[model samples]
Target: MLKGKRILVAGAGGLLGCKLCADVLSAGALVVAADINLAAMDERLQQHGIASDDARVARVSLDLSDSSSVEQFFCSLTDLDGAVNCTYPRNKRYGAKFQDVTLADFNENVSLHLGSSFLFMQQCAKYFISNQRPFSLVNISSIYGVVAPKFEIYENTPMTMPVEYAAIKSALLHLSKYVASFMSDSRFRSNCVSPGGIKDGQPEEFLQNYRSYCLGKGMLDISDVVGSIIFLLSDHARYINGQNIVIDDGFIL
Candidate 1:
């Protein structure tokens, strides 16, 4: 669906990010695998079947938190079709308990992740606008952003939804809406995908509680999100904009 296209996959070393890169490459788009850590970028590319000399794949170190870096990165690209941002920036102790949340951590996360996300989106919009081209941007949000977190699901688990994540993701949906409508003027498209809990190694008790809330399976895998992302970035979805497509397996219902 994305043949001959040039797509940038930010946070390409991450779990969802790597999966998205593989899928985009399979769809025949030139992927710029971008992440902060260059040391791991090559390994991530190799894991996704991209070789060092592969013309279709380019590796770049991106500090999404840096505005100058963001601008320079976008400025360097040419014939860019679109981008997918799956970057999740957080401090060292990210998963803080709800009551244990601190203002310092909250502000740092919000400013770092949320602020960087805005700069990324805005920079992409600016690039497309200057080039007078049509492009699509997909921002990864969360199901928690769509609905309040179910504290019951995390009852026996060692997890509680962090306040900063909720704040950043929920606002991201609105930010996509704003970028799609307020930035482009019909030339650029901005959309969001809000995914539910992707199973890693959560306890059975948490998984069971989570399943009870789902219409189908309990949690999602990388494959579940890749297809939706490809469709959104493809020309077939050219008409889709200012939309938040939720992929939570009915967890929100």
Candidate 2:
């Protein structure tokens, strides 16, 4: 469905990013995989058995936190049809009270999730407006953005969940909506995908616990997010704009 399209995927080194890249390539789209860790991405590509000779894939080193880096990356693109913002902070600690969260943690999360996305969206919108080309953006958000997760999980782990992560994600959602409204006159669409706890490479016990808590909540592989992403990027979602699609196997219900 994405034939002839050029798509840029942020966070291409991570688990979900890898799966999304493969899916977009399989759909006949040209992909530019951008990540901060180029070596990690190369290793992942090799592990996944995707050949370097594949014409559909390209890799670029991108540091989203740096404005200059973000500008340089987007400036190098000649034609961009769509972008997927899957970039996230490296930590996965999911339990902490808001009062216990540090200022550094809050700033870091905002920089990675909200600030970087805002810069990219601004640049892309400018490109679309100036070039008069239609484009789409798919921002990846967490279910925690909509509703808080159980804090009990953090009690056993070394990681501490900060309320800032959730706050930044919610901010990203609003950012998407604001961008969508700003581009309402143009052929640009911005939306969000909020997925429930994805079970990519998680331990059996953790998965089991999550599954038990979220009974009837179908476990989603990274591949499950690809279809929704593809739909959002394609002309098929031409009329869909400023909407947040939650993919959590009905867990939110």
Candidate 3:
């Protein structure tokens, strides 16, 4: 239960990010939803039926790749108790072998998945350290970062298998650990959540294949991952830090 806490969620327009924001708000937390596309955020908020006067929810237009913008955003916040890094690049039209991966594709994924997360965490850490406040950061990663899938799931969809995504996610986990270690004496904490395959209107054939494969292995939906995030961000996980919790229904097993 995060009541009266100030929480910032980057990439708040995405499916998971939207769910997280709504849940956090329902839990009585003040949420700052930051996204590159304000229109998308507006649409999402409207769909959620959140009114303009809802002081508990604020939509901010943020370009995470821009360092000055990120700094300004964080500086504007009065009390940042927690942050969730869920920003991801458009995964459409970009699946290929490592050798076939283009520089642009690689850079785009890296900038969003890795660069943005690093910048946000760095800013949050500085603020928390200087203000002597106990804060937590939950970074969203993928199960693929830990275990390579036999088949490329993002191929047919706008999503793709890029070396940069995997590399950056792996790096994010380590970065969380490093931040945790550096602030071991402080109240600042950082951790990662690696979710498994998320089903969201994929082709029926593809969905069947994915479900069968994952069933043979083990996979779960987006809801399965929310609990871990809630725990990591809540006071319940105050002592937990520098850890990567995988919630993939034993797919990695």
Candidate 4:
């Protein structure tokens, strides 16, 4: 559906971001994978049978915390048909317990990621408007944004859902919705995708505990969310705007 489309994937070095980039490339789209550093591992990309130097993929440097960097990245590009923000900005206090959550870390993290998303949207709007091109923007949110964290699942585990994430992600949905509605052209749409817990390198006990809470898919692979993202970015979903497509396996229920 996205053949020849040029997609900019922010936070492209991370696990979920890399998977999305790979999928986009497989669909015959050009990928401008940007992150704080172009640290996407060759082994990781090749794990999916995609080579690191594939002609379709271009790696760029980006830092979400800096507005100048965000603006510079967008200004440097003229071929972006769509952009996706899959950034999960964190620091020392990210996974801290709810009680231990501090205002400083929360605000800092939110400001950086949210600021990046904002600048991305602004530049995207400018680019689309000035170029008279139809464009799409996708913000990666979490199922926790839809519903509160089920504290019970983390019991006996060292995990506690970051309070800052909840605040930031929920705000992201509203931001996307506003942009979708706020835009003049329906073609320049903004939407969000909220996925459930993606299986990473969590402890075995934590994994077991987490798996028991799901309805169908016990835990998500990074690839699970790619379809939803591709759909939203492609022209096939032109009718979809100002919407939040949740990819959780009833975990939020």
Candidate 5:
């Protein structure tokens, strides 16, 4: 679907990010794997059998939190067709429970994740406007952003869906819409993909609880979420803008 495209996969060191690079590469796009840790991102890509010197892969370091870094990276680009932001930025105390979360930590986490998202989205739009080229940007949100958390599912688990995450992701959906509208050109579009809980070694009890709310697939794998992203980035979705595609196996239903 993305043949001949040059796509940027931010946060390429992450599990989802790395897998996304491989998937898009298989679809024939030149994958620019970016992360704050260049070495780590390269290592992760290698784990997925993407050679460091792969002809279709280019690895770069990106720290979304730094304005200069983001600007420099985007300015350095010449023909970026699309980008998927899979970066999940957080401080050390990011996942604390609601009650345990201090106001300081809350602000910091929000600034780290949401602020960086704003920066990246703004840069993408600016790049398109300046170059007058067609561009697609896919921001990764979450099912929790669409609906309230199923607190029951996380009961026995040590996870409580961090309050910061809820705030950041929910805001991101609206942010994408805002950018899409602000851009106002069909060729320059922004969209979002909100995936349900992705399996990442959570306890079975929690998985069972999660499954009860889903339609068969208890939790998604990284692969399950990439197709929608690839579609949004492809010309197949040329007219699709400011839309949110939920891939949660009916979890929010």
Candidate 6:
């Protein structure tokens, strides 16, 4: 869906990010796969059979936490059609149970994730305004952002939905809308994709618990969310702005 377009996949080393890079490249977009870990990002791309010298894809390093790095990255770009922010920055204590979360940890995690998202959105909007081109910015959110967590699903597992995650993601959806509205331009679009639990080696018990709430698939594979993202990046969704597309089967129902 994204042929001939130049799309940037930040956090390209990550699970969803890597898959996104490969799929978009497959669809003929010139993919700029970027992450702080350049080597790892390259490795992930290779794992998907995308060579470093592919010409259609470029691997670069980007640290979303640093303002100068983000500014320089945007400044260096030209003719960029779309970008996705998949970077999940968090402190060491990120996944602590709700009751076990410290105030400091909560504040820091929020700052790292949500704060960086704000910076990214700001830079993307600036890029659209300066270049005077159509640009789409996709923010990865979670189903937890749209609905309260089902604590029962994690009953026997070591996971409890982190308080900080809920705060970050829910805010991201609104922030995307805020940027789109602030831009007030049909050319600049900002949207979100909120996916349910992606299978990442969670206990079978937890998986079964999760499946009970879904209509069909229990947990989505990383690939399940890619098509929607690519759609948002392409002209097919040119009029779809400031909307949150949830890919959670029927979990939220």
User: TM-score for each prediction?
Assistant: 0.97, 0.90, 0.89, 0.94, 0.99, 0.99
> In model 5, which regions exceed 4 Å deviation?
none
Question: Model 1, stretches more than 4 Å misplaced?
Answer: none
Query: Cα lDDT of all candidates, in order?
Result: 0.88, 0.80, 0.79, 0.82, 0.93, 0.93
Q: C-alpha displacement of 244 in model 6, angstroms?
A: 0.5
TM-score of 2: 0.90
| Tens digit of per-residue lDDT, candidate 5, span 195-238 | 99999999999999999999899899988999999999999999
Model 3 lDDT, full chain set: 0.79
- Candidate 1 residue pairs in clash (backbone atoms < 3 Å): none
Q: Rank all candidate structures by their lDDT, best first, as comma-separated numbers.
A: 5, 6, 1, 4, 2, 3
TM-score: which is higher, 3 or 5?
A: 5
Q: How high a TM-score does candidate 3 get? A: 0.89
Q: Residue 236's C-alpha lDDT in candidate 4?
A: 93
Q: lDDT for model 5, please.
A: 0.93
Q: What would the TM-score be for candidate 6 when compared with the true structure?
A: 0.99
Local error of candidate 6 at residue 101 (angstroms): 0.8
Residues 106-148, candidate 3: write the lDDT tens digits: 7777776688788988998988877777898999888877877
Q: Locate the minimum summed-lDDT window of 10 residues in model 5.
A: 152-161
Model 6 C-alpha lDDT per residue in residues 1-253, reported as the tens digit of each score: 8888999899999999999999998888998888999999899889988888888888888989899989998999988999999999999889999889999999999999999999999999999988998999999999989999999999978888999999999999999999999999988999999999999999999999999999989899998999999999999999999999999989999
Tens-digit lDDT track of model 2 for 1-253: 9999999999988888888888888888999988899989878776666676777788898888889878777777877899998787634533346776667766766776688889988988887887777898999887777877766644554444467777887888899999999888548999999887777565565556556656475568787778998999999998899998888876666
Per-residue error at 229 for model 4, in Å? Answer: 0.4
Tens digits of per-residue lDDT, candidate 4, 102-121, equal 88987887887777678777
